[model samples]
Target chain A: MQDVTITINGDIVTGTIDERTLLLDFIRDVAGKTGTHNGCLEARCGCCSVEVEGDIVKSCNVLALQVAGRSVTTIEGLSKERLRPVEHVTSQSLAGMYAPLEAMGADVNDLHPVQVAFHQCHALQCGFCTPGMVMVMKNYLEENPEPTRDDVRTAIAGNLCRCTGYQHIVDAGMMAAETMRSQPDNSRPAPARPAHDH
Target chain B: MRAFTYLTPSAPTEVVEMLDAHAPDARVIAGGQNLLLGMKDRSDSPAFLVSLGGVSELEGVRAADSGELVIGAATTYATLARMEFTGWHAEIASVCGNLADRPVRTMGTIGGAACAADPRYDIPALVTGVGASLEVLSAQGVRTIEPSDFFLEGGGTSLQPGDLLTAVRFPATEAFTTVVFEKFRQRVFDAALASTVLALRVGDGVIEDLRLTVGATTPRPTVCVTSTAGLIGQPVDAIEPVLVADAAAIEVLGPETSNDPPHLRYQRELIKSVTRRALIRATAIPRS
Candidate 1:
């Protein structure tokens, strides 16, 4: 066993974990941040993707002890407010059941551009893969402010989403790129477009 | 994953000392993208893991006085991709950036891939194709091993239990005029089913030197020196890619047998096609 301390979303999370403990487990179990989903324990699935010192990595593939004193940002860190959980959001009642970012108490300005774009474009269906997709997209858009459709596709190739067919996710990525490009200084969030009525 | 002791050493010498102390049961972790995966599956259960993350000396790229390029063992692929490389060395950057996904590239190091010695991985083949050497440090001393000797015959490395690979040294940039690497995979992020690396120098439109290496098909990346020997001194246009590729495939795979498995046959075909493509692409580049 080893004492590992890591900064998750600006909060210091220290745990006495086994040397074999994965960063994924450290985040979810120790830090209590379940936004970072656990998909395939293998690195093939990017559901465990998180930012370590501003660079994205599959947390599952990394050991907690390897990043003992590093700062990590998970899906929870992307925005100031969390959306209220909706057990089952079907297309029939999606409009009524899903509330807009503002209505859900999430400040539109606090959410990352990628998150805003995902909400606007309905990029997520079941939303199981949203955290990883959003994290990867946010990181990719920062590096490449002007990515083409194919570039967005390639950037998120590691992240898998069985739902939404990836068409809307790609659209959200392109939209987010435009928003990021327009704002040279991303300190302020992109203006929230009118929410999806349907 | 089994419980183990983790050691973080800041210097190469310290890493070797830790490995020396643990010997046989201790393993050095660089990037740990592949090592951790193996550990999770219980395929590898090292009692001690010596991490090279804090070793500043073993990170970044430097040029040796001999003009060879020395890349630190812990330098990640993302760093290589972002670097501005000149001439044929840019091929290395391209290969580094394109293979694997974005997140994996951020953490996967070239030295780690080479040490892992997985045939499906691209680094070993590219290193061998470019005629690079691996520098290793152990309690005994530091030594450089050529790729031919560094990589074992059947999908493993020749590194001993106490050995820690410190860096990969590439031949002088002037050695190869141009290099082209080609591979075939099922998906965008899948490892290469078969990959080929072709490096050559042409003087006045005639082949001066050529090196062809076929990877993934063989247990280790095999350099086709004899098969490509006939191409030397031949005009660039006179070389037939298909014929050269056929000779290389046969040389690497041996004569096709009726009892060969279906995957073996497929690999042979992949080897030929990728090698042929690499040759065509390499010859088409305008020589300075």
Candidate 2:
């Protein structure tokens, strides 16, 4: 066993790992942070991606000891215990636009406009691929306030979503970007914008 | 991957001590991407993996006051790709920049690439194009060897166990030189089926110097310095014909002779194209 010290999300943790232990196994099994899920054990999928020393890298292939003193940021580290609602207007006008699976996943009694657009466009069929898809879309939209369908496609290439055929998902992402950009801050509804809100 | 002992030594003396202690079973890990991949496959396992990352003296990119371009062996390809290069060397830098992906470029270091001597890699031939000489650190201290003289047959280098490649130095040249690199690969960012780099020095409206290098179609890429000598002082009209004639000299040195391998034809075409481009660049720019 080797002693390893690394930051998980925001906490500094130190532990001993077997010589053969991999970082993905340590994070999921030892730390029990399931937010970092596993896909292909090989390097093809980005589901195991985490930021190590500021560079995006696959965790499955990295040995635990390799990051002995490095800072690693996984999906679990993105926010506080409660997400602040940054609601805005134009959340309805673009609801008539392309499909967004995340928006539709929300119940109608508490629907987000992004979800409404997904239902209107029928963006999601089998929701099995939704989590990774939403994360991919969220990551892309955060970087690109405006993206072409091709840009959306390239951003999502490393991710696999056999369900929904991808065309509708691409449409959903573009529509969400347009909606988010056009919205004005005071237009937010007084209620909580569900924690799952994008 | 099997468990292996890891070590990172700060001093060259300590590195030699570790190499002496580990002996033949020791393997140096620069960027674990390739070495660890092999370990994962259970292909070739080492008892120890010594990381050269801690050796600060082996990391640099300096055109020394002597005009020699001295690059530390552990320097990443990305660093070299972004550096200023003139003459025929630009082709080498550009080829390296686009070597693997941007990630691979950032991860893999030149010392590992050259020492691996795998014909599938591009930089080995590029180093030959620049006439760079290598420095290796071992228990015996340091020794220098030119790339051509240092490569072994069957696409491996002359590196021995416990010997760490230290740095590579390219002799200085003034303006009036040019290098053109041409590669033929089936896909973008894929390994080249055939690759060539041509370095030339032009003077008095004629070719004054040349270095011809070809890769990926042989056990180890061969340098055709003989054919290059024929190009010195040759005018533009005779340069192209000389290259075409030199193609006959580039035959695989080992057992895989099948009338005409696609690799061989592609190799010749790469030589022709790179040479043609390098000549055009050299005469136009005038690198001394």
Candidate 3:
């Protein structure tokens, strides 16, 4: 066993995991953050994506011990702190890049622009791949804030959804881009580190 | 996966010592992108995994004083893609950027990719195509292997059990040369069904020097040295499709030695087309 202390979802957690333990298993089983799902352990499905050191990586392809002393953000960490007081002024407290989603009330309130667009555009069928898709778009839009339909298609190519046929997802991403760019600078939360989850 | 002891050695010497101690039972894991999958599948059951995470020295890309480009073996593809390369190196960056998906690029290292030597991979062809040499270190000492000799006939490299690949060095490309990598895959992120790296040089209006490497469809990346020599002195636009087809057929695909004649024929045809397209695209724009 190797000792690993990692920062996950703004909390520091330490665990002694087997050398063979994958980061995806560590996040789900040891850290008890099951928001990062595992679709294909072989790193193809992109369901096990997470942010480590400001880049999104397939956690299943990474060893748990490799991320020792690093900060990892799973899907659970991608939202603003609901536990904090409503008027909490810490703008940077959110460990993820989904501020636009939170501002539009994607969680526990009104749907985020991406969520609303997905709902309106009918981007999902089973919703198993929704978390991964949202995570990819959140980071992709930050890099290419004004993406065309082709750009949106290329950005979400890694995250596969069998049911939706991808046309609706592309439409939803394009809609979210317009929604994100049109918002005022202050209305949008500060840009978080670009996530590279799958 | 079977449980094993994982050691993170800080220095390259320490890595060699650990490897010497473990020898045949040990595996040096840089990124674990491919190794982890192999371990999970029980294909590679190493008793000891020497993780090189703490070895910071083996992680960067630099232009040496001698005008040679030196890239640390452990440098991740994401980092390499972000580098400002000139001439031939830019071709390398383009290929590295296209390897797998964005996340996989973050974790996968050039050294790991080169060492794995999987025929379907892109890096081996890129390095060998650029005429780069690998720097390897072991308990005994350090030595450089030329690109032509570095990759073995089958998968994997000439690296010994205790050896750690330190870096790869490429001599500076001439000003007249421009390199381009072309790959045809089923998807944007999938491994190449057929790939080629072409480093073409034009003098006046004629082809000066050409280095072509055909990958993915071959058992190893085939550098068409003699075949490329045949193209020299011919005008870039005057180079016919028949020349490329004949070269790929004779040099890259040995028609008589193929076990599966039909598949070999299809691959030869694919190689011919990919090589031609890569050459055209590479020559279309002259490097400044």
Better of 1 and 3 by TM-score: 1
Q: Tell me how candidate 2 scores on lDDT.
A: 0.64
Tens-place lDDT per residue, model 3, B101-211, is 877888899999999988779998888777888999998799999976788877568888999999988767673378878877778878887788887778886888778
Candidate 1 lDDT by residue in tens digits, B28-139: 8888999988998899999999998889899999989998989998999999999898778889999999898999998899999999898989999999999899999988
Q: What are the per-model DockQ values?
A: 0.83, 0.19, 0.56
lDDT, candidates in the order shown: 0.89, 0.64, 0.79
Query: How far is A83's C-alpha from truth in model 2 (Å)?
Result: 7.3
Candidate structures ordered by TM-score, highest first:
1, 3, 2
User: Arrange candidates by lDDT, highest first: which order?
Assistant: 1, 3, 2
Please give, for residues A1-198, the per-residue lDDT of candidate 3 as tens digits: 777888998889888888888898899988998778888899887878888877878899999988888999777775554433335434444323345345434442233455555655667777778777877776677667888888787767678788988988888787677767775341343333223222
User: Which stretches of model 3 miss by more than 4 angstroms?
Assistant: A83-120, A183-198, B256-260
Error of 3 at B42 (Å): 0.6
Order by DockQ, highest first? 1, 3, 2
Candidate 2: where is the Cα deviation over 4 Å?
A31-49, A58-61, A75-198, B84-93, B173-176, B226-229, B241-258, B261-288
**Which prediction has the highest lDDT against the true structure?**
1
